[model samples]
Target: MQNKIESLYKETLKIRLFEENLIKLFSDGKITGTTHTCIGQESNAVGIASLLKKDDCILSNHRCHGHFLAHTNQYVGLLKEILGEEDGVCSGIGGSQHLFYQKIFYSNGILGGNMPMATGLSFANKMKKNNKLVCLFIGDGSFGEGNIYESLNFISVFKLPILIVVEDNGIAQTTETKNTIANKIEKITASFKIETSILNYPDAYDIYTKSKKIINKARKGYAQIIVIKSARIGPHSKGDDTRSIKQLNLIKKKDPLIKIKKKIKSKEKIKKINLDVINEINKIFNFKSQSYSNRKVSLQNKKNLILIDNPLKTFDGKRFGELINHFFHIIAKKNKKILFFGEDIVDPYGGAFKITKNLKNLYKNQVFSTPISESTIVGMSSGLAIEGYRPIVEIMFGDFLSLAFDQILNNLSKFYYMYNQSITLPLIIRTPMGGGRGYGPTHSQSLEKFFYGMHGINIYSLNPFFPLEKIYEEAFQNINPNLIIENKIQYNFILDDLNNSKYKSLNTKNDIKNFITNMSLSNYEDDCRTIICHGGASSAVINFAYDDFIETENSSRIIILSKLNTLNIEEIKKNISDKGPIIITEESYKSFGLGSEIITTLIEDEKFKGRNYMRISSKEGVIPSSKSKEEDFLLSAKTINKKVYNND
Candidate 1:
């Protein structure tokens, strides 16, 4: 007991001193971003962390310095991270607010965001039967967030191995918790039938004893909560302390470090430990290390063309929707690690679009119908992916993706880079996009443009001409996360050889005809203009104006591109004629959309400087519910024809 007390005091002292030094550094303008200090609340983190096994997972909130120190114990790495040094933990991408160590530790700046991710990690633990528990550290402020409630319900329903640690410091940044929160933490969590434990300003030994019981229960596939009534000694962040001197003095009196030191009662030993810790920290800061450089992380070691020669066998005359259903069925059957998560995607409903019909019937354990929480759906998939499971999540409509932007942009897209390429998030988020079905403005939107430039994520569009089986195979095998954008209009289209044929024109003398003939005969055309189109817009352009444009424009040819990001610029340039005009078209709005990106790419090419460039896209406006108005809002055959013939 004496030894444990000494160890706890040492850990607490380490965190307190580290944060104290950081506070001084920030005051002197040494540290850049704002820092959240857990000086008085060290007992909560150090206590619970003591019970965690090496493989157990921890998801922390903004005030995560104590958690990072307690969990990882990498003094130099944590100090360097707070200092924003490149060699720091997370390679300096994650400042004090965002710190990730290996697969077990993760912290984020968003309140209540880590709750769902922690629940997900618990789900993965349960799925893999790893006998590991996931601990989530959230603030009192998170009690007011809907995400925490959603995560709690999900964890309870699934009986995941997770322990939620609510560090109630009585203050949520500037606002006191009593002013913002209505109910007590214990009472609120009890409503969910979750087992709860409350500790009031316990010392390190008290915390360790209480948390070990809860965590042991959690490891047996039970969901639990431990509320630690702690105090914040310093300001919420740098330069933000609003507490009065009296309140500050009261908090300092209850400091865990002081209490533990009193119990140890050895001044010489304590002084010696403090000196050693201080010297170690100083050495890490003074060590002359090489400056940091941003390195590009790649999913593929070598650039290899995606070959589609061996396609999954599909029944004759399958529609696009049926083909999608077939693809999921085959892939899920072949790979047991693939799990499907979405709203209303099980059994009879089979998803909002009926694309996932019959999946749950075959793979009942692997497939699950989620609630309407888009954030948890995506956030949990990130956790599952990190745990070595290929989670294919469906978002129903692409417009709803805005709800999950934080998880997709800040969490999913950055996990690989932030972790210095130590982990891979092999997650596939498949959602139906485009605007032809009259589902109104909110329901029907081609929002792929918003995610165009995100690194570490691949965006794919389903083309009627291509085999769905091959796309699914590639998506399942991809090392990084992929967003498969399926057009609602193309769901019912019949699969045929006509859709797969190369560009053809009724006019025999058209340049597209010459280009196709030359390519077929192993000849090349140097002056052939190229037209690029993707998604439903490609079908619209091909059906309404292909023959007429071919008859009129003798210097232009057309090709369909499905993959949007990580574009094969070299391959596209190989087909284009030298200095020829390049025309790009899309169904999305023109502002900062795919068409704009393509134009920018061409403009940046030194060899394509003299080339004529044009983009045919929808005007910046809402898609009307009426079919005629929607057509007018989108780029159509008439629009393309006018742009080609009249140069409008």
Candidate 2:
């Protein structure tokens, strides 16, 4: 035990020296950008490292250099990463704050952003029965994030194996936690009813003894939290700390490295470790690993299946929602790793729309319906994806997507690039939108516009008039997050029921991604007006055009955009050039949706600028609960005709 403490002291001293050199390097301008060093908190990281197993996962926040150095000992890789060199870990894309190593150490820059994902890694370990636990290192300031509480509840309720380490330095970016956090962090974790421990100014050996028990307890099936009152002897970031000199001196006095050194009797061992750590820092400038660069993402799918098969070739009079629900069974039956997550998504109630009806009963182990924690749902999906699980999350309603938007933007959408392409975020967020149902403002909304600008995610609106091409299969292989928007009223419409003499779904030879690209109804005519929309909107346009309500020809062409973001610009232009007047219709708000984005891009060309076109959408007002008022507030074929001819 004496030798163990001496060994731990050397490790702690090494971490301390490494971070101090990093600070010195920053001052000398050798490292560009910013870095958060764990100068005084070296012992806490070393403690966590001592208990780490080969398969155990460790997630750290911004001040991660110490944890990474103590855990990985890849000082050269870390330094090269900070220098943005090609040979650094993660190919130099993830600098100091963000890192990935051996699929074990994950460090994110966002505050509390990785907690939910940590739960996911724990969930994966538990599901696989690997007996591996996750060590998530967060700050006391992270309690301010609601998802942290959500993650705690998830970890506790599910009993996942995770040792949550709260390295409470008492400050978040210069503001003390007392000023920002109203409740004690321990009390909050205690509320989850999980095992908890708190340590104040503990030395490395003390933390090691306590953490080993904590890690072992958590590995046995219970999730736990350890709040270590560590100190930040250095600035939050270079030159960013606001602590006074007197306060800093007090924090330094409690430094664990100093305490551990006093407890060690052997001076020669300490000198050797210090010399070794310093020598490594000196050689870091000349280190080489792998040429690193940020991963570039393209919306285009690399696999263009020529003979793509569509299982749902023709619906047998089943409603649109029921048909999709059947496909859910098919997808789940095919992939055992495919997981379903949502509120009320299990058997009995199924989903709010019944798309997930009977899924839980069939795959009890895979399907999970939980409390109204949308952020946790997305975050867990991200974590599960990282652990090699294909997760499909339902957002109950598309309007509620805003609740999970931060994780979608930060974790799911950014992790692929942030991790330098070492991992893929293959999760699906399926939800119903539009004002047809009386779900009011909070529930019934066409919120696709909010997801338009978020990169690294695919947006697809299902069209009953067309075949549901292998979207689920592609979603897993596409190496990105997918959002499938469903319309409530459209769910009742039978598949391919809209196909008639006027217009029918077509698979043109111009498809780039499987067959969904040009898989919409088209009548090749350069004279008739080309009305355009997607998903449910296509049925309304076909109904009006086929019934001769406005006496439009059968070949009057309609392009139902299945994939909204990556538009086939050439195909659209080729179909619309010198053709009938362009009429763009969207089921959502009056401005800035699929229709607006398409028309806005097309108008830039001379061929479209002079064309007579009309943009039809839901009028700007509250989507009322009444059926008649809801129809009046949203876009339909009648509304499109009214807007087009009434002004004329």
Residue pairs clashing, model 2: 86-290, 86-291, 86-292, 87-290, 91-292
| Per-model TM-score versus the true fold | 0.88, 0.92
Model 1 lDDT tens row, 509-615: 21221111112111234335566777787677665444553465444455566677767665666556564568788888777877677778777989777778878
TM-score of predicted model 1? 0.88
Model 2 agreement with the true structure over 1-648: per-residue lDDT tens digits: 878888898788777777777788889988889899888898998888888887688899998888887788777778778888776776777899998886778898888888889988888998899888888999998889898988888888888989988998898888989999988888878889988899998888999887777788999888888999988888888998778999999999999988988877778877776788677666664455334333333434533222334556533546888888887777787677889989989889999999999998998888998768999988888888877788889999888999988888888888877776767777888888887777776777788878886788888887665566455556667677888888888889765554543434342333435223332234353335677777667666766554533465334456667666556666677655356578777777757676777778888988788777777777776778888887778777677667656742
TM-score of 2: 0.92
lDDT on C-alpha atoms for all candidate structures: 0.77, 0.78
Model 1: weakest 10-residue lDDT segment is 513-522
